[model samples]
Target: MGIMGCCSDFLQRVKPYVAMISLQFGYAGMNIISKVSLNHGMSHYVLVVYRHAFATLSIAPFALILERKVRPKITFSIFVQIFVLGLLGPVIDQNFYYAGLKFTSPTFSCAMSNILPAMTFVMAVLCRMEKVDLKKIRCQAKVVGTVVTVAGAMLMTLYKGPIMEMVWTKHVHPHRSSAPETTDSSDKDWLKGSMFLIVATLAWAALFVLQAVTLKQYSAQLSLTTLICFMGTLQAIAVTLVMEHKPSAWSIGWDMNLLAAAYAGIVTSSIAYYVQGLVIQSRGPVFASAFSPLMMIIVAIMGSFILAENIYLGGVLGAVLIVVGLYSVLWGKYKEHKENKKSKVMSLPLTLKNSEGNGEGMDIKDEDEKGKKANSMNLSTSDDRSTIKVRFPIPEIPMKVEAPNA
Candidate 1:
C-alpha cells in the first residue's frame, strides 16, 4: 500500500507534464499534416469542415460514455458560450492558421505561434482570471516575458536573415511547397501571412480564456469538447458551402487529405481538447498555453525533414527569444505557486493555534483543566456568591465579583 501510494503521488506530479507534451506532439503533427494537405490543394474551409466532422465523431463516444452520469445540465447560456468557442477555435483560429500556412512555411508559422503564451497571459489578466502583482518578482518576470515573446514574434515576421539551410534537406526538391522560394515574394507574403496568424493567435487566446471560464460552469471535459466539435462542424460546413461552391473542392478520397483530417480530428482536435480541458481545470489557461513553444520546436525539427524547410538566422534568433520568454513566464508562475503553498502552510499552524486558544499549546492536560474550570464555575454560580479574578477571560463568567445573595 505504501509503495502504491508513493507511485500514485509520483504519477500525480508528472501527469500535467505528460499531458502537455502529448498535446504539443499532437499539435505539431497536425500542423505538419495540415500543411501537406493544403499543399495538395485542400481548401482551409473544406479542411475545417472535415476536421471537425471527424472530431465530432471521434469525441462523441467518449462524451456519451464518460460523462453520462456526472455531466451537468447544459443551460442556454452555456450553449451560447460553447458556440462562440467553436467560432473562435475551429472557425477563426484553425482556418486562419491554415490559410497563413499556405502563404508561409510551417516553421515560420510555428515560430510566430510562440506568442500564444504571452497572448494568453495578457488576455487572462484582462479577464481577471489571472492577477498581476508588479511588486513581486513573479509578476515582473511575466511582464518581461510577455514583452520579449511579442518582440520575438515581431522579429520573426519582419526579418528573414540569410538561410541557414539544413544538410539533411539537401535531397528534397528546392521548389517544394515547404518554402516561399524567394526573399522578395516572402517579404510580401510574410505580411499577409502574419496578419492572418495574428488573428488566429488572438482568436486562440480568446478561446483559451473562454474555455477556462466555461469549464468552471460546466465540468465535463469530454462533453464540452464534443459540443465544441459539433458546433464547429456545423459552422465550418456552412462557411465551406458558401466559400467553396464547387462540389469537387469538397471531394476527399483515400489520400493525404483524408489521413490529415483523420489524424487531426482524433489526435489534435478531440484528444488534445479533452486533455487541455483537464489541464486548464487543474492549472489554468496560461499554463496550458505555455507549452506552445514545445510544439514550435517539434514542428521546426519535423518541418525541416518532412517539409524540406530552411531554417534561417532570424528564425533561430526569434525562436531563442521566444523560448527564453516562455521560460521566464513559467519561472515566475512557479515562484508564485511556491509562495502560495508556503503561505498556506504557514497559515495552517496559525489557524490551528487560534482555534485551540489555550494559554499554552493544546494538550490532554489543557482539556482536563477546561473541563474542571467549567464545573467549578457551575458550582460557584449555584452555591457561593463571590467575585472571581480571571487572568484568561471566560464568556459565561464575569471577571468582576457579582454578589447575587447580597
Candidate 2:
C-alpha cells in the first residue's frame, strides 16, 4: 500500500509534464503536415476555417455530454470573452501562423515560436496574473530566462549560419532532389515570415492569458474548448470569405489538405485546448506556455526528416539558448511552487493552533463558570443549614429542660 501510494503521488505530480510533452509532439506533427498541405496549394484562410469547423464538430459532442451537469451559465460578458477568444485563436493566431509557415520553413517558424513563454510571461505580469519580485532568486531566474529567450529568438531570426548536416542527410538528399524543387525564399521573405510569426506568437500569448481568465468564469474545460472552436469556425469563415473569395481555393480533396484540417482540428485545437486549459487552471499560463521550446525541438527534428529542411548552425545555437532559458524559467517556477506549497504547509499548523487556542479559551471560560456555579450552590446550602439551626435551637432546649424537671 505504501509503495502504491507513492506511485500514485508520483503519477499525479508528473501528469502535467507528460501531457505537455505529448501536446508538443502533436503540435510538431501539425506544423509538419500543415506545411506539406500549404506547399500543395491550400489557402491559409480556408485552412483556418476548416480546422476550427472540424474542431467544433469533433469536440462538441464530448463537451455536451461530459459537461451537461457541470457547465456554467453563459452570460453576455462570457459570450464576449468567447468571441474574443475565437478571434485571437482561430482567426488571428491560426491565420498569421499559417502565413508565417507558408513563408518560412516549419523549423524556422517553430524556432520563432520558442519565444512564446517569454511573451506569455510578460503578458501575464502585465495582466497582474503573475507576480515578480527581483529580490527573489526565482524571480531573477524567470526575468533572466525571458531575456535570454528573446535574445535567442532574435539571433535565430537575424542570423542564418552554415547548414548543419546529419547522418541521414546523404540518403535523404537524393529523394528531395528527385521531388519537385521549391523556390528559395529571399532574406526579405524571411523577415516577413518572422514578423508574421511574432504577431502570431503575440496573439497566442494573449489567447493564453484570456483563456486563463475565462476559465475562472466558465470552469468547464471541454465546454469552453468546444465553444471556442465553434465560435472560431464562424469567425474564420467570415475572415476566409473576406480574404479568399475564389470557391476553388476553398476546395479540399482527399489529400494532405483534408488530413491537415482534420488532424489539426481534432488534435491541436480541440484536445490541445482542453488539455492546456486544465494545465493552465492548475499551473497558470506561464507554465502552460513554457513547453513551447520543446515543440520547437520536436518540429526541428520532424521537419528535417519529413520536409528535408536544412538545419542551420544559428538555429542550433539559438535552440540551445532557448532551451537554457526554458529550463531557467521552469526551475524558477518549480522553486516558486515548492516555496508556496511549503509555506502553505507551514501555515496549516499555525492556523490549526489558533483555532485550537480559541476553542481552549472557550473551554476554560466554561469551566470557570461551572466552578463558580458549584461554589455558589455550596454556599447557598451552608446558609440554609445555618438558618435551620438558628430557627429551631430554642424549642429543642426548652423541651429538654421540662423533661429533666418532671
TM-score of 2: 0.79
Task: Assess each prediction's global lDDT (C-alpha) against the native.
Answer: 0.83, 0.83
Ten consecutive residues with minimal summed lDDT in candidate 2?
A: 384-393
The stretch of ten residues in a row with the least summed lDDT in candidate 1 is 374-383
lDDT of 2 by residue, 136-216 (tens): 999999999999988888888788787787777767675554545334566678778888999999999999899889989
Using all chains and alpha carbons, the TM-scores for the candidates as numbered come to 0.80, 0.79
* Every candidate's CA RMSD: 8.4, 10.4
